[model samples]
Target: MEPTPTKETVELTTESGTLRRRGEWVVPRLLRIRSQAGAVRLDMSQARIAHPVVDIELSVLSGSIVLVLPDGATADLDRLHSPHASHRSRVPAVPTHQAPHFVLSGETYTGALRVRYARGHRRR
Candidate 1:
Protein backbone atom coordinates (compact mmCIF):
# COMPACT_ATOMS: atom_id res chain seq x y z
CA MET A 1 0.00 0.00 0.00
CA GLU A 2 1.12 3.54 -0.77
CA PRO A 3 0.96 6.27 1.81
CA THR A 4 -0.78 9.54 1.10
CA PRO A 5 1.11 12.77 1.28
CA THR A 6 -0.23 15.28 3.78
CA LYS A 7 -0.33 18.95 3.03
CA GLU A 8 1.33 21.33 5.45
CA THR A 9 0.69 25.04 5.63
CA VAL A 10 2.13 27.77 7.81
CA GLU A 11 0.34 31.07 8.20
CA LEU A 12 1.41 34.44 9.62
CA THR A 13 -0.98 37.31 10.05
CA THR A 14 -0.60 40.77 11.55
CA GLU A 15 -2.18 44.18 11.45
CA SER A 16 1.12 46.04 11.71
CA GLY A 17 4.82 45.88 12.55
CA THR A 18 7.27 43.34 11.16
CA LEU A 19 6.84 39.64 10.66
CA ARG A 20 10.07 37.82 10.10
CA ARG A 21 11.17 34.20 9.81
CA ARG A 22 14.83 33.43 9.63
CA GLY A 23 17.59 31.22 10.95
CA GLU A 24 17.13 27.44 10.91
CA TRP A 25 13.36 27.32 10.72
CA VAL A 26 11.34 24.61 9.04
CA VAL A 27 9.37 25.88 6.05
CA PRO A 28 6.17 24.13 5.16
CA ARG A 29 4.80 23.31 1.71
CA LEU A 30 2.42 26.25 1.84
CA LEU A 31 3.06 29.62 3.52
CA ARG A 32 0.47 32.32 3.87
CA ILE A 33 1.11 35.86 5.10
CA ARG A 34 -1.48 38.52 5.74
CA SER A 35 -0.73 42.01 6.99
CA GLN A 36 -2.55 45.31 7.07
CA ALA A 37 0.70 47.27 7.37
CA GLY A 38 4.42 47.08 8.17
CA ALA A 39 6.97 44.61 6.75
CA VAL A 40 7.15 40.88 6.21
CA ARG A 41 10.47 39.20 5.72
CA LEU A 42 11.14 35.53 5.13
CA ASP A 43 14.72 34.42 4.99
CA MET A 44 14.87 30.93 3.56
CA SER A 45 18.57 30.93 3.07
CA GLN A 46 19.37 28.38 5.75
CA ALA A 47 15.93 26.99 6.43
CA ARG A 48 14.74 23.46 5.84
CA ILE A 49 12.06 23.25 3.21
CA ALA A 50 9.50 20.47 3.48
CA HIS A 51 8.89 20.29 -0.24
CA PRO A 52 10.63 21.04 -3.49
CA VAL A 53 7.81 23.33 -4.48
CA VAL A 54 6.37 25.97 -2.14
CA ASP A 55 3.30 28.11 -2.50
CA ILE A 56 3.07 31.51 -0.80
CA GLU A 57 -0.08 33.54 -0.52
CA LEU A 58 0.42 37.11 0.64
CA SER A 59 -2.03 39.88 1.41
CA VAL A 60 -0.67 43.23 2.43
CA LEU A 61 -2.50 46.51 2.55
CA SER A 62 0.65 48.56 3.05
CA GLY A 63 4.40 48.33 3.72
CA SER A 64 6.70 45.75 2.07
CA ILE A 65 7.39 42.06 1.86
CA VAL A 66 10.80 40.61 1.21
CA LEU A 67 11.72 37.01 0.46
CA VAL A 68 15.33 35.95 0.61
CA LEU A 69 15.78 32.60 -1.02
CA PRO A 70 18.74 30.30 -1.11
CA ASP A 71 21.05 30.18 -4.07
CA GLY A 72 19.59 28.57 -7.21
CA ALA A 73 16.06 28.86 -5.85
CA THR A 74 13.37 30.38 -8.09
CA ALA A 75 10.13 32.22 -7.50
CA ASP A 76 7.06 32.69 -9.71
CA LEU A 77 4.89 35.74 -8.99
CA ASP A 78 2.67 35.69 -12.04
CA ARG A 79 -0.48 35.04 -10.03
CA LEU A 80 0.09 38.00 -7.70
CA HIS A 81 -1.98 41.14 -8.26
CA SER A 82 -0.42 44.35 -7.07
CA PRO A 83 -2.07 47.27 -8.80
CA HIS A 84 -0.74 49.93 -6.47
CA ALA A 85 2.46 48.14 -5.59
CA SER A 86 5.74 47.13 -7.15
CA HIS A 87 7.21 43.67 -7.58
CA ARG A 88 10.92 43.07 -7.86
CA SER A 89 12.80 39.80 -8.10
CA ARG A 90 16.46 38.95 -8.41
CA VAL A 91 15.65 35.25 -8.79
CA PRO A 92 14.70 33.46 -11.95
CA ALA A 93 11.10 33.01 -12.99
CA VAL A 94 11.57 29.48 -14.23
CA PRO A 95 12.29 26.59 -11.91
CA THR A 96 15.56 24.71 -11.94
CA HIS A 97 15.84 20.96 -11.76
CA GLN A 98 16.11 19.66 -8.17
CA ALA A 99 16.00 23.22 -6.85
CA PRO A 100 13.43 24.72 -4.56
CA HIS A 101 10.63 26.60 -6.33
CA PHE A 102 8.26 29.18 -4.87
CA VAL A 103 4.92 30.22 -6.34
CA LEU A 104 3.49 33.49 -4.96
CA SER A 105 -0.09 34.68 -5.25
CA GLY A 106 -2.61 37.12 -3.68
CA GLU A 107 -2.63 40.93 -3.57
CA THR A 108 -0.56 43.81 -2.25
CA TYR A 109 -1.94 47.32 -2.05
CA THR A 110 0.40 50.27 -1.75
CA GLY A 111 3.35 48.07 -0.92
CA ALA A 112 6.16 46.15 -2.54
CA LEU A 113 7.19 42.54 -2.90
CA ARG A 114 10.87 41.89 -3.35
CA VAL A 115 12.43 38.51 -4.01
CA ARG A 116 16.13 37.98 -4.05
CA TYR A 117 18.90 35.52 -3.35
CA ALA A 118 20.41 35.29 0.09
CA ARG A 119 23.35 37.41 1.13
CA GLY A 120 26.71 36.23 -0.21
CA HIS A 121 24.85 33.87 -2.51
CA ARG A 122 24.73 34.39 -6.24
CA ARG A 123 22.34 32.98 -8.77
CA ARG A 124 23.40 29.80 -10.41
Candidate 2:
Protein backbone atom coordinates (compact mmCIF):
# COMPACT_ATOMS: atom_id res chain seq x y z
CA MET A 1 0.00 0.00 0.00
CA GLU A 2 1.10 3.55 -0.61
CA PRO A 3 2.01 5.73 2.35
CA THR A 4 -0.12 8.68 3.33
CA PRO A 5 1.15 12.12 2.54
CA THR A 6 2.47 14.30 5.37
CA LYS A 7 0.46 17.21 6.77
CA GLU A 8 2.05 20.17 8.58
CA THR A 9 0.45 23.04 10.46
CA VAL A 10 1.06 25.54 13.27
CA GLU A 11 -1.47 26.21 15.99
CA LEU A 12 -1.65 29.51 17.83
CA THR A 13 -3.64 30.48 20.91
CA THR A 14 -3.57 33.43 23.26
CA GLU A 15 -3.02 31.31 26.34
CA SER A 16 -0.28 28.95 25.10
CA GLY A 17 1.25 30.80 22.17
CA THR A 18 2.45 29.23 18.87
CA LEU A 19 2.89 25.52 18.09
CA ARG A 20 4.39 24.15 14.92
CA ARG A 21 3.61 20.60 13.72
CA ARG A 22 5.91 19.27 11.10
CA GLY A 23 5.74 15.73 9.67
CA GLU A 24 3.25 13.20 11.01
CA TRP A 25 5.21 10.15 10.05
CA VAL A 26 5.90 7.42 12.61
CA VAL A 27 7.20 10.08 14.99
CA PRO A 28 5.51 13.44 15.20
CA ARG A 29 7.74 16.47 15.74
CA LEU A 30 6.06 19.37 17.50
CA LEU A 31 7.65 22.81 17.89
CA ARG A 32 6.43 25.56 20.16
CA ILE A 33 7.33 29.24 20.69
CA ARG A 34 5.90 31.44 23.39
CA SER A 35 6.57 34.79 25.00
CA GLN A 36 7.54 34.17 28.59
CA ALA A 37 7.27 37.54 30.29
CA GLY A 38 9.14 39.59 27.67
CA ALA A 39 11.28 36.80 26.28
CA VAL A 40 10.40 34.27 23.62
CA ARG A 41 10.77 30.70 24.80
CA LEU A 42 11.28 27.73 22.52
CA ASP A 43 10.25 24.34 23.77
CA MET A 44 10.15 20.92 22.07
CA SER A 45 9.16 18.99 25.09
CA GLN A 46 7.18 15.77 25.42
CA ALA A 47 7.41 15.42 21.68
CA ARG A 48 5.84 11.98 21.31
CA ILE A 49 6.58 11.57 17.67
CA ALA A 50 5.86 8.30 15.89
CA HIS A 51 9.07 8.62 13.87
CA PRO A 52 12.31 9.79 15.45
CA VAL A 53 14.07 12.00 12.96
CA VAL A 54 17.82 11.89 12.38
CA ASP A 55 18.14 15.63 12.94
CA ILE A 56 16.13 18.78 13.61
CA GLU A 57 17.15 22.39 12.97
CA LEU A 58 16.29 25.45 15.06
CA SER A 59 17.64 29.00 15.10
CA VAL A 60 17.06 32.18 17.10
CA LEU A 61 18.09 35.81 16.84
CA SER A 62 18.03 36.56 20.59
CA GLY A 63 16.61 34.32 23.28
CA SER A 64 17.39 31.54 25.75
CA ILE A 65 15.37 28.35 26.12
CA VAL A 66 15.38 24.63 26.72
CA LEU A 67 14.01 21.61 24.84
CA VAL A 68 12.22 18.92 26.78
CA LEU A 69 12.37 15.49 25.22
CA PRO A 70 11.44 12.05 26.49
CA ASP A 71 14.15 9.87 28.07
CA GLY A 72 14.68 7.64 25.00
CA ALA A 73 14.41 10.33 22.33
CA THR A 74 17.66 10.00 20.37
CA ALA A 75 19.21 12.69 18.17
CA ASP A 76 21.89 9.94 17.48
CA LEU A 77 25.04 11.55 16.09
CA ASP A 78 26.29 12.96 19.35
CA ARG A 79 24.12 11.14 21.85
CA LEU A 80 25.19 13.55 24.55
CA HIS A 81 25.22 16.53 22.22
CA SER A 82 22.73 19.27 21.53
CA PRO A 83 21.72 17.53 18.34
CA HIS A 84 18.51 19.50 18.19
CA ALA A 85 20.58 22.63 17.91
CA SER A 86 20.32 22.23 14.16
CA HIS A 87 19.21 19.74 11.49
CA ARG A 88 22.57 19.56 9.71
CA SER A 89 24.54 17.89 12.46
CA ARG A 90 25.78 14.36 12.98
CA VAL A 91 22.83 12.42 14.35
CA PRO A 92 21.37 8.99 13.92
CA ALA A 93 17.94 9.10 12.30
CA VAL A 94 14.64 7.64 13.40
CA PRO A 95 11.96 6.28 11.13
CA THR A 96 8.61 8.05 10.85
CA HIS A 97 5.91 5.76 12.18
CA GLN A 98 2.33 7.00 11.80
CA ALA A 99 0.13 10.04 11.60
CA PRO A 100 -0.46 12.01 14.80
CA HIS A 101 -3.14 10.17 16.71
CA PHE A 102 -4.12 11.88 19.95
CA VAL A 103 -4.27 15.67 19.69
CA LEU A 104 -2.50 17.51 22.47
CA SER A 105 -1.02 20.98 22.38
CA GLY A 106 2.71 20.96 23.11
CA GLU A 107 2.34 24.49 24.38
CA THR A 108 -0.79 23.36 26.10
CA TYR A 109 1.18 20.38 27.50
CA THR A 110 -1.43 17.77 28.44
CA GLY A 111 0.84 14.92 29.52
CA ALA A 112 3.70 12.73 28.42
CA LEU A 113 3.74 12.74 24.62
CA ARG A 114 4.39 8.99 24.70
CA VAL A 115 0.96 8.59 26.19
CA ARG A 116 -0.77 11.07 23.92
CA TYR A 117 -1.80 8.25 21.59
CA ALA A 118 -1.69 5.45 24.13
CA ARG A 119 -5.41 5.11 23.55
CA GLY A 120 -4.83 3.70 20.05
CA HIS A 121 -2.35 1.07 21.16
CA ARG A 122 -4.79 -1.67 20.14
CA ARG A 123 -5.17 -0.50 16.53
CA ARG A 124 -2.27 -2.36 15.02
Candidate 3:
Protein backbone atom coordinates (compact mmCIF):
# COMPACT_ATOMS: atom_id res chain seq x y z
CA MET A 1 0.00 0.00 0.00
CA GLU A 2 1.12 3.57 -0.65
CA PRO A 3 1.98 5.56 2.44
CA THR A 4 -0.11 8.65 2.88
CA PRO A 5 1.74 11.95 2.57
CA THR A 6 2.27 13.54 5.95
CA LYS A 7 3.54 16.82 4.47
CA GLU A 8 2.03 19.38 2.14
CA THR A 9 3.00 19.19 -1.50
CA VAL A 10 3.91 22.46 -3.25
CA GLU A 11 2.27 20.98 -6.33
CA LEU A 12 -0.70 23.12 -5.39
CA THR A 13 1.27 26.12 -4.21
CA THR A 14 3.45 26.76 -7.27
CA GLU A 15 2.02 28.75 -10.16
CA SER A 16 3.31 28.54 -13.71
CA GLY A 17 5.61 31.20 -15.19
CA THR A 18 9.07 32.60 -14.51
CA LEU A 19 9.30 33.54 -10.84
CA ARG A 20 12.21 35.66 -9.58
CA ARG A 21 12.98 34.93 -5.95
CA ARG A 22 11.75 38.25 -4.46
CA GLY A 23 13.53 40.44 -1.88
CA GLU A 24 13.06 38.29 1.18
CA TRP A 25 12.58 34.77 -0.04
CA VAL A 26 10.23 32.47 1.79
CA VAL A 27 10.89 28.75 1.88
CA PRO A 28 7.84 26.97 0.54
CA ARG A 29 6.73 23.49 1.53
CA LEU A 30 6.86 21.57 -1.74
CA LEU A 31 8.78 22.89 -4.73
CA ARG A 32 7.70 20.88 -7.69
CA ILE A 33 8.21 21.30 -11.42
CA ARG A 34 4.88 19.88 -12.53
CA SER A 35 5.02 20.99 -16.17
CA GLN A 36 7.49 21.54 -18.96
CA ALA A 37 6.88 25.23 -19.55
CA GLY A 38 6.98 26.14 -15.90
CA ALA A 39 10.35 27.68 -14.87
CA VAL A 40 12.18 29.46 -12.05
CA ARG A 41 15.15 31.79 -12.56
CA LEU A 42 17.67 32.93 -9.96
CA ASP A 43 19.19 36.20 -11.15
CA MET A 44 22.58 37.40 -9.98
CA SER A 45 21.26 40.84 -9.10
CA GLN A 46 19.66 39.52 -5.96
CA ALA A 47 20.63 38.91 -2.36
CA ARG A 48 20.73 35.69 -0.36
CA ILE A 49 17.14 34.66 0.16
CA ALA A 50 15.73 32.92 3.23
CA HIS A 51 16.30 29.66 1.29
CA PRO A 52 14.09 27.58 -0.95
CA VAL A 53 12.57 24.15 -0.50
CA VAL A 54 13.14 23.15 -4.09
CA ASP A 55 14.63 25.10 -6.95
CA ILE A 56 13.25 24.81 -10.48
CA GLU A 57 15.93 26.05 -12.89
CA LEU A 58 14.20 27.81 -15.71
CA SER A 59 15.21 27.23 -19.33
CA VAL A 60 15.33 30.89 -20.20
CA LEU A 61 18.54 32.82 -20.43
CA SER A 62 18.65 35.12 -23.43
CA GLY A 63 22.18 36.15 -22.51
CA SER A 64 25.06 34.60 -20.61
CA ILE A 65 25.08 35.06 -16.86
CA VAL A 66 25.40 33.17 -13.61
CA LEU A 67 22.36 32.64 -11.38
CA VAL A 68 22.23 31.59 -7.76
CA LEU A 69 19.43 29.63 -6.20
CA PRO A 70 18.23 29.81 -2.61
CA ASP A 71 20.12 27.85 0.05
CA GLY A 72 19.33 24.21 0.96
CA ALA A 73 16.80 23.55 -1.82
CA THR A 74 17.06 20.67 -4.23
CA ALA A 75 18.62 22.54 -7.15
CA ASP A 76 17.55 21.53 -10.62
CA LEU A 77 20.41 23.03 -12.61
CA ASP A 78 20.56 24.06 -16.27
CA ARG A 79 24.14 24.53 -17.42
CA LEU A 80 25.44 27.41 -19.55
CA HIS A 81 28.40 28.03 -21.86
CA SER A 82 31.03 30.66 -21.18
CA PRO A 83 34.66 31.64 -21.87
CA HIS A 84 35.88 29.14 -19.30
CA ALA A 85 33.35 26.48 -20.08
CA SER A 86 33.33 27.09 -23.81
CA HIS A 87 36.73 28.42 -24.84
CA ARG A 88 39.07 27.79 -21.95
CA SER A 89 37.88 24.27 -21.07
CA ARG A 90 35.94 21.67 -22.98
CA VAL A 91 32.45 20.62 -21.91
CA PRO A 92 30.95 17.39 -23.17
CA ALA A 93 27.44 18.64 -23.85
CA VAL A 94 25.41 21.65 -22.87
CA PRO A 95 23.16 20.28 -20.17
CA THR A 96 19.50 20.92 -20.80
CA HIS A 97 18.28 20.09 -17.31
CA GLN A 98 19.84 18.85 -14.06
CA ALA A 99 18.48 17.46 -10.79
CA PRO A 100 19.96 17.64 -7.34
CA HIS A 101 22.98 15.32 -7.11
CA PHE A 102 21.94 13.15 -4.20
CA VAL A 103 19.33 10.78 -2.93
CA LEU A 104 15.82 12.24 -2.80
CA SER A 105 12.94 10.59 -0.98
CA GLY A 106 9.94 12.45 0.38
CA GLU A 107 12.16 14.76 2.42
CA THR A 108 11.66 18.47 3.06
CA TYR A 109 14.20 21.27 3.47
CA THR A 110 15.45 24.69 2.26
CA GLY A 111 18.48 25.61 0.10
CA ALA A 112 19.77 27.27 -3.04
CA LEU A 113 20.73 26.28 -6.60
CA ARG A 114 23.46 27.83 -8.69
CA VAL A 115 23.68 28.11 -12.51
CA ARG A 116 26.25 29.73 -14.80
CA TYR A 117 25.79 30.75 -18.41
CA ALA A 118 28.06 31.61 -21.33
CA ARG A 119 27.86 34.34 -23.92
CA GLY A 120 24.97 34.29 -26.42
CA HIS A 121 23.72 30.96 -25.11
CA ARG A 122 19.96 31.01 -24.80
CA ARG A 123 17.94 28.48 -22.86
CA ARG A 124 16.88 25.67 -25.15
Candidate 4:
Protein backbone atom coordinates (compact mmCIF):
# COMPACT_ATOMS: atom_id res chain seq x y z
CA MET A 1 0.00 0.00 0.00
CA GLU A 2 1.84 2.99 -1.29
CA PRO A 3 0.51 5.82 -3.35
CA THR A 4 1.20 9.50 -2.94
CA PRO A 5 1.73 12.03 -5.66
CA THR A 6 -0.49 15.02 -5.99
CA LYS A 7 0.77 18.57 -6.32
CA GLU A 8 0.07 20.94 -9.15
CA THR A 9 -1.05 24.53 -9.46
CA VAL A 10 0.28 26.56 -12.35
CA GLU A 11 -1.65 29.52 -13.64
CA LEU A 12 -0.37 31.58 -16.52
CA THR A 13 -1.89 34.49 -18.42
CA THR A 14 -0.68 36.64 -21.29
CA GLU A 15 -2.18 39.41 -23.36
CA SER A 16 0.55 39.87 -25.94
CA GLY A 17 2.86 36.87 -26.53
CA THR A 18 5.29 34.19 -25.22
CA LEU A 19 4.70 32.15 -22.05
CA ARG A 20 6.93 29.13 -21.90
CA ARG A 21 7.82 26.45 -19.35
CA ARG A 22 9.61 23.55 -20.89
CA GLY A 23 9.97 19.76 -20.46
CA GLU A 24 8.63 17.45 -17.74
CA TRP A 25 7.14 20.39 -15.85
CA VAL A 26 6.49 19.90 -12.16
CA VAL A 27 6.84 23.04 -10.12
CA PRO A 28 3.53 24.29 -8.91
CA ARG A 29 1.86 25.18 -5.69
CA LEU A 30 0.72 28.52 -6.99
CA LEU A 31 2.78 29.93 -9.80
CA ARG A 32 0.74 32.62 -11.42
CA ILE A 33 2.14 34.98 -14.02
CA ARG A 34 0.12 37.60 -15.83
CA SER A 35 1.37 39.83 -18.60
CA GLN A 36 -0.15 42.49 -20.80
CA ALA A 37 2.60 43.12 -23.31
CA GLY A 38 4.10 39.60 -23.40
CA ALA A 39 6.99 37.28 -22.51
CA VAL A 40 7.17 34.96 -19.49
CA ARG A 41 9.70 32.19 -19.52
CA LEU A 42 10.30 29.53 -16.90
CA ASP A 43 12.79 26.86 -17.82
CA MET A 44 13.04 24.66 -14.75
CA SER A 45 16.52 23.58 -15.71
CA GLN A 46 15.42 20.13 -16.92
CA ALA A 47 12.35 19.98 -14.69
CA ARG A 48 11.36 18.80 -11.24
CA ILE A 49 9.89 21.11 -8.63
CA ALA A 50 7.74 19.01 -6.30
CA HIS A 51 6.92 21.98 -4.13
CA PRO A 52 7.98 22.78 -0.60
CA VAL A 53 6.44 26.20 -0.87
CA VAL A 54 6.57 27.84 -4.28
CA ASP A 55 4.31 30.80 -4.71
CA ILE A 56 5.28 33.09 -7.55
CA GLU A 57 2.95 35.83 -8.60
CA LEU A 58 3.78 38.30 -11.33
CA SER A 59 1.99 41.00 -13.24
CA VAL A 60 3.77 42.78 -16.03
CA LEU A 61 2.68 45.63 -18.24
CA SER A 62 5.28 46.02 -20.95
CA GLY A 63 6.57 42.41 -20.94
CA SER A 64 9.53 40.17 -20.04
CA ILE A 65 9.95 37.68 -17.19
CA VAL A 66 12.48 34.88 -17.14
CA LEU A 67 13.20 32.28 -14.43
CA VAL A 68 15.50 29.34 -14.92
CA LEU A 69 16.81 27.27 -12.06
CA PRO A 70 19.01 24.23 -11.42
CA ASP A 71 22.13 24.59 -9.38
CA GLY A 72 21.03 23.97 -5.89
CA ALA A 73 18.16 26.25 -6.81
CA THR A 74 16.75 28.50 -4.13
CA ALA A 75 14.85 31.75 -4.37
CA ASP A 76 12.94 34.21 -2.20
CA LEU A 77 12.30 37.66 -3.62
CA ASP A 78 9.61 40.23 -3.17
CA ARG A 79 11.12 43.51 -4.26
CA LEU A 80 10.80 44.38 -7.88
CA HIS A 81 10.20 47.73 -9.49
CA SER A 82 10.27 48.65 -13.13
CA PRO A 83 9.74 52.08 -14.55
CA HIS A 84 12.29 52.00 -17.31
CA ALA A 85 12.79 48.24 -16.71
CA SER A 86 15.59 45.99 -15.48
CA HIS A 87 15.65 43.53 -12.58
CA ARG A 88 18.09 40.65 -12.34
CA SER A 89 19.08 37.83 -9.98
CA ARG A 90 21.96 35.47 -10.46
CA VAL A 91 21.10 33.33 -7.45
CA PRO A 92 21.65 34.82 -4.02
CA ALA A 93 18.64 34.75 -1.76
CA VAL A 94 17.84 31.78 0.39
CA PRO A 95 16.67 32.37 3.90
CA THR A 96 13.03 31.83 4.63
CA HIS A 97 13.71 28.98 6.99
CA GLN A 98 14.79 27.20 3.83
CA ALA A 99 13.19 24.06 2.41
CA PRO A 100 12.81 24.66 -1.26
CA HIS A 101 11.10 27.99 -0.86
CA PHE A 102 10.59 30.10 -3.93
CA VAL A 103 8.35 33.00 -3.09
CA LEU A 104 8.48 35.87 -5.55
CA SER A 105 5.95 38.62 -5.92
CA GLY A 106 6.23 40.95 -8.89
CA GLU A 107 5.05 43.96 -10.82
CA THR A 108 6.95 45.19 -13.84
CA TYR A 109 5.75 48.13 -15.87
CA THR A 110 8.43 48.82 -18.44
CA GLY A 111 9.55 45.15 -18.53
CA ALA A 112 12.51 42.81 -17.90
CA LEU A 113 12.83 40.67 -14.78
CA ARG A 114 15.20 37.75 -14.82
CA VAL A 115 16.29 35.03 -12.36
CA ARG A 116 18.72 32.59 -13.81
CA TYR A 117 20.73 29.88 -12.03
CA ALA A 118 22.07 27.02 -14.08
CA ARG A 119 25.78 26.44 -14.18
CA GLY A 120 28.02 23.41 -14.76
CA HIS A 121 27.80 19.66 -14.19
CA ARG A 122 24.64 18.00 -15.36
CA ARG A 123 25.15 14.72 -17.10
CA ARG A 124 23.57 11.72 -15.56
* Residues 1-124, model 4: lDDT tens digits: 5333546666789899899987656777788788899998888877766666678877788888888876556676655556687888877577444436677877787878888765573533
TM for candidate 1 is 0.91
Residues 1-124, candidate 2: write the lDDT tens digits: 7654433433232232333332222333443234322222222334335444423322232223333333333342222222222213111234234322222222311211111122222222
> How well is each residue in 1-124 modelled by candidate 1, as lDDT tens digits?
5433545988899889899999878888999899999899999998887688999998889999999998888999999988899999999999988679999999998888899988788544
Q: Which ranges of candidate 4 are over 4 A from the true structure?
A: 1-9, 14-30, 35-50, 55-57, 62-75, 84-102, 105-107, 110-124
Which is better, 1 or 2, measured by lDDT?
A: 1
| Best-fitting candidate, scored by lDDT | 1
Model 3 RMSD in angstroms: 13.3
Candidates by TM-score, descending order: 1, 2, 4, 3
What TM-score would candidate 3 get against the native? Answer: 0.28
- Give the runs in model 1 whose Cα sits over 4 Å from its true position: 1-7
For candidate 4, the clash count comes to 0
The lowest-lDDT stretch of 10 consecutive residues in candidate 1 is 1-10
> What is the alpha-carbon lDDT for the whole of candidate 4?
0.75
lDDT of 4 at 40: 89
List clash counts for every candidate, in order. Answer: 0, 15, 11, 0
Which candidate ranks first by TM-score, i.e. highest? 1
